[model samples]
Target: MPSKRVRYPFQVLALCLSAWGLAWAGPPAEKDKAPDAASIRRGKYLATIGVCEACHTPPAVPAVPGGGDPDRERLFRMDPDWVRYLDPQRQLAGGVPFILRLSGTTHGLVVTPNLTPDVETGLGSWTEDEIVEVLRTARRKDGRVLFTFPPHSFYNHMALEDARSLARYLKSLPPIRNPIQPRTLPFEPQPMVADGPARAPQGRTRERATYLMGALVGCRECHSHHENGTLVEFAGGSPSDPFQGSFRLGPDLPLRQLEKGFAAFPYPGFAVLYGSNLTVLGHGGALERVPTERIVRAIRQGIDVREDEYGRPRPIAHVMMWQFYKDMADVDALALADYLKTLTPVANPVGVRLKLFGTDWEAAFQQTYGEPPTPEDRAAFGMP
Candidate 1:
């Protein structure tokens, strides 16, 4: 019966302090050092594969058409033009503002967050392990996981080597001292379901190509935009926004305007065309139409369908695919050609509803097809 007065709270406090002290003693010994130049270069390459700049960089305006600005202070700022059209007050992005458009409609704009290593506002304090954990796990502050990293899924099907390299590269970038506000989703955060372990596909060339296309190059992300202009999945239904469709690259430009010794060309001057369905119905369709040999020739030779001044298929712009594909040893271009042929056309109509009007279609259906029983009907049955 020594000191029967409640010592429970004090005991709890002491335990908490003891735990804190242990944690503060410093992280368990591990070799955490700055990555080497080769690792950094690998990281840079992986970052390109993920097309990290696309979201991190602000939308390109007429003043800055290509959207390549590296200035951190202005990075990831919501496009002013888009803000004017959507929210006049422009409340989000300065802080965690409620995003009304995302939930109210099928399509909505999501302000991308800044990833620069700014101490006050950016990820400057994040350790390499923390960064790796974020990409690998997709966890929120409360320890809930996210379904997808909307717009661009860098972690979606991401290879471990590539993820690590990208993380290292991000850490190495010169810290841009900009404090971007956090992103706000329309709905309350839903806990993320953990997908299975990442599997690197077999076949070196196929694996590398898939990594480039899926994680790094991000062909699917660019081609797929939700009706609200967000790039959620490879659903490929994003509307024509500011940068939705500005450049076209292929064998289909007016010949006279084409540059010397080139068949395929990049048409940046054309009216902004919404991204064509990359499925079997669109450009992927064209690729399927040709033989693997022709496909290889088209990429490596850059030959336009039309002839050059020398009466040969003029070499078009150097397709980077040719260079990348050349290094691929597996399946050759035929396998890629075959794979491109397999892309299914998205059956959903494009531009059916760019903006939602908020009508309750379900209620309308019930009224027309199955009306609720009237009070008289219930009374006749002696029902309460």
Candidate 2:
């Protein structure tokens, strides 16, 4: 019998296709599995702790005028209820612009994006893999870099699994079609603020805490002081409580003397609250003195401390929602505490920096707010 020519059809086809600059087509790749309910729920909780709404939610229709300008308002009016009761539909459909003012000059702008799942406007087009890419690399799916969000730094310390959990959760949100315009802004560049060394530094516990406190829990907003004239302010806490007469010694107090001592003012000038000097370590700051248990309580359940508003108490100056952080993992809480202890003890007091140093409120209005707002203007802003 003649030798049979064994036909290697598959091999020959592969070779031919390779030579022709293409591979034989195979079945279409499978899509990623959708996140389960459990994952989505987990992500929702994480988002809350991160205070994602602070930068993401469109500013509420203020009871005051000028609601059109979202930037000219306190974050969620510093109202714990306002933040907690955000509209679910518009939640994460971001268009809020956060302006960082220092010494009376606009230092930078941070306008967030809509995080909803809307196909045309939000994260609906995103996959979990893209989420992972952002948390890990700070790069967009299309190859652009993300802005310097608090998450951008600490998430680098997060576990892939946790990052995945966050991604899964975000992807699972109900789609909303709110169109957020371009979020970038034109402002003076500020120096990069490093989150400092890892808060945990040892086990799976390491980095987890700092991510929550420094990035997620958001204490740095209230628990910090500016160096070389940086704006130092926090949500839900104001120093000068006009109602209670608790106006503390600060720059805008009495004579606009630019005195430092943890200064803060609500939008539209409702109240001026001061943040506690957090970097001093022992006397007032809890870092070297307070027990971890107490610190944890303060983080999860608010303390009963009070600030003065015209010499009367007004719900601790502004509403602080520690309950949102109730479910923090134990390891993460410890991590947050550890990070808190590591805040390089800055002896300086907290104060807001305005454009014209040592100028009175009237000049400040023209220099900072433009054309001194009247009592109606202030009330219209719902701050006073």
Q: Quick one: best TM-score, which candidate?
A: 2
lDDT of 1 by residue, 36-58 (tens): 55555656644433334333443
RMSD in Å for model 2: 18.2
* Segments of candidate 2 deviating more than 4 angstroms: 1-31, 34-38, 59-80, 99-110, 149-154, 184-207, 226-274, 279-291, 304-323, 329-331, 338-346, 349-384
Please give each candidate's TM-score. Answer: 0.47, 0.57
Expressed as tens digits, the lDDT of each residue in 220-334 for candidate 2 is 5454433334434221222222111122112221101111111222222322333454444433453477566655665666653332456543333232345455655555566
Q: Which candidate number has the best lDDT? A: 2
